[model samples]
Target chain A: MSVLDEVLSANEAYAASFDKGGLALPPARGFAILTCMDARLDPAKYAGLSEGDAHVIRNAGGRASDDAIRSLVISYKLLGTSEWFVIHHTDCGMEFFTDEVITGLLANSLETAALGDDGFYDVGTGPGSDHGQHIDWLTISDQTQAVVDDVVRIKEHPLVPPRIPVHGFLYDVRTGRLIEVPVPSDESAA
Target chain B: MSVLDEVLSANEAYAASFDKGGLALPPARGFAILTCMDARLDPAKYAGLSEGDAHVIRNAGGRASDDAIRSLVISYKLLGTSEWFVIHHTDCGMEFFTDEVITGLLANSLETAALGDDGFYDVGTGPGSDHGQHIDWLTISDQTQAVVDDVVRIKEHPLVPPRIPVHGFLYDVRTGRLIEVPVPSDESAA
Candidate 1:
């Protein structure tokens, strides 16, 4: 059976015993969290959020990119979220590649790269071949700086209100501890 | 104290007891989940996932936009994730407004729209004013179709390998139940 079948089966049991069905559409806590897609780092458990608490947006590196900002705008504007959290975790796969080098990595088969760059060969059939859909992986060598930059991006974006407080954190995936990354003072900090 | 300060304080206690710090970079299960930003629906719990299991990519409505595709590309090519799961939920705020109407709603203040659009007044200072940063919220009038279309998009994307199996689910946020949305027998399901 496929892994999805397993999840669906699990959902059957979850639904059987489910009780919290009437939570409001908007998050109860009036905030949104942008965090990595790492499975070990369960954002809800570590963040002290219960059902209906806050919006949790996860991506590969949790780097508040354009799409993330788009979501943040909706979270705050349409969904009533006021605060935003950007959380990047330690020992992330993001540290494995530099943003520039990842373009080559995105082209070649994982099988080719898994052994190391020695065997790297582009399929040329993938999205990398299409110049229009190309995207930077945004991998990071210095995660602290990345988190700080993403927080600043959200803070400075005109779409984000000045009243909204954006905070950045580096999460230790192994220990489940979060260390706050201080944002640099700028016009947006005002 | 701010909710973030509270979270940081809680993290101190969590870090004191931290143990699992050795999990590898690639997801142990070799899959990724695309879902909404709802707080009430914890992806790990509902999806029967534990730490270090699967990558979870989330955005406003879990729509498979260019940014989402970018993350999925990275998840599969660089991180060894093969399967993709798109899970949208019921009672979603996405159902509250259309994509075009949301641009107008994205302006000025949240309290103004939280009450209703009748009170909505554009601030003329936000991203709504910037024609370039404007993003279609990808709002959905029919979510089930949205999930199926998103799944098809992933399956057809050049970056996503043909062998990768993509599945769609409509999660009932109220009941914590996930109903599988089967891919239509057409272009990408081969």
Candidate 2:
């Protein structure tokens, strides 16, 4: 079966036993989490969230991209969340390629690139766009530093309230541990 | 205890018994899902995803914003995900406000707004910014149409491979069900 069909079938089983029919519009736990879209890091499992616990905003590197900031703004501004967490993970695919490399690959072809021992290489067919060059891609170099940077970015965004404590952490994909990434004293104090 | 402390405590237990430590960097299921950050929807449980099953990109409304497309591009390009799903849920907070309403709230104060019977009303303190004015917010009008629009946006993006089938669905918040939103015949054919 297609993944869509498989998941929908799973949903049927989930809904058959579904008792969480009255969860409020706002998060019950009064916090939000920003994490990577990595398949391995299940925020609900790692963070022990039941439905209606916290807002989860995820993207490529979980970096505080403008869009992520927008989500965070809405989460706190309209939804009553007070605290926030920026969680990136180890072994992230984002660590494998630079913006230039991915853009170049997209410029060559829209086909999937092969990840060799060295790194990703384009198969090179046709029908690509220059629009890839316009995006930041938000690739990561150092996982620990990326976490700190995202926390700082979210904490410092003008729309984000200074009272909301934004914590940074790195999830270990191998061991399922969340290691706290210390924000610099200066940034943390701010 | 703070919510952070509560979750960290939970993470310790999860890590202690962790055994799935050898999963690869790419998704084992070869699919990606884009959905809302609503606390009521646990994508893992609803979709039957284990750790390393599929890429899950989430935001405020699960709309196909530029950043979402960037993540989708990277998901298929570098990570080998073959299919994608766009899911927006019922009773979404995104349906509670508009760009003008949110921006006006932020302009008044960065404080959280109250959702009354009429709609969201600002608490209004001070120390706000006009930055919210610059954001698209990507709020929802009709939940069903939003899912269709996101799926179409992702499918039509020039960087997206034409062969990847982008499916649309609306998750029922009350029932924990995944209801397929019919993509228009023309878009489905494309």
Candidate 3:
């Protein structure tokens, strides 16, 4: 079965575990998670969550910026979210890349978009051939300070309530388990 | 109340609602998503997902290259998932960036850790920034195409299964309503 198929199959089994739940289904007795779009990793296997329980959001390195925070504001204020889970893993591509390069490239490319080299840019098949090589700056190989910083960013974020719990976890690509990192509580002076 | 306070308060109510379900344990839920690191967009409110339901993930237009995909696969497969939601808003920032400038800038700055400035480098934030961007080529602005392509990619992915049922959505920042995009039964056709 393909990755989607396995998830579906697992979802069926997972859903079967709790068809009609207590009260109103706990809203997110199931959840929607936002993580990176990396192909080699599997979420349900790592986060200890299963199908029929959560929603998964995959983007790059699962970074929570103004935009994602905006969505979080909505997901909680309007959607009824209770907990916050942010996972930044080891050997992440996010570690190696940089913003200036990306945005700058766009600015340059757009400036020259209408013209090839100088006009009619090639939007199709970008940069290199591998399509697999991640920018070095984008990759976060270690799971320490980065995870803490992200968690702190989430917890202290003015957008989120100081008390709204935000967690930081590490999903070891090789092992497929999300290890929760020790983060200072939102109330911590440090 | 701050965004977190607002969410926590609502979570208290949401959690109270859960008490009747017998799970009765929490004052809050999980995960708040910050995307793009782009301030102009909203993912959940626009995607139609209920508030307090799930965390949001934002980066460069929600592209799931091998790196991001690997993390998601694990988050879903192991952590547990039932819904896989994509909240790509109109006029995304991913539409503005590229791989060239990203690689070039990084290699020049960290010139030592060169991944070759001329290839398919994924640009993003500097070390510890956790701000991730995307490769210009793989990301698409067309909602229909992006959604269909993502769903198909997730569904047909060799690593995932067919039954996973990936869903696509467009969030209109103006409307604040999650517009569900239709995925062709076989969106992979294109």
Stretch of 10 with least lDDT, candidate 3 chain A: A107-116
Residue range B63-143, candidate 3, lDDT tens digits: 444434443443333223334655565555344334444334443331112223473333333331212232233445465
DockQ of each: 0.59, 0.87, 0.04
Docking class of 1: medium
- Candidate number of the best DockQ: 2
lDDT of 3 at B84: 64
The 10 consecutive residues of candidate 1 chain A with the worst lDDT sum are A124-133
lDDT of 2 by residue, B141-163 (tens): 98888888788888888899889
Error of 1 at A187 (Å): 7.3
Better of 1 and 2 by lDDT: 2
Tell me which residue pairs clash in candidate 2: none
i-RMSD per candidate, Å: 2.4, 0.8, 17.4
lDDT by residue (A127-161, candidate 3, tens digit) is 31221223322334455776676667656654455
Best-fitting candidate, measured by TM-score? Answer: 2
> Runs in model 3 with CA error above 4 Å?
A1-26, A30-34, A100-142, A185-190, B1-190
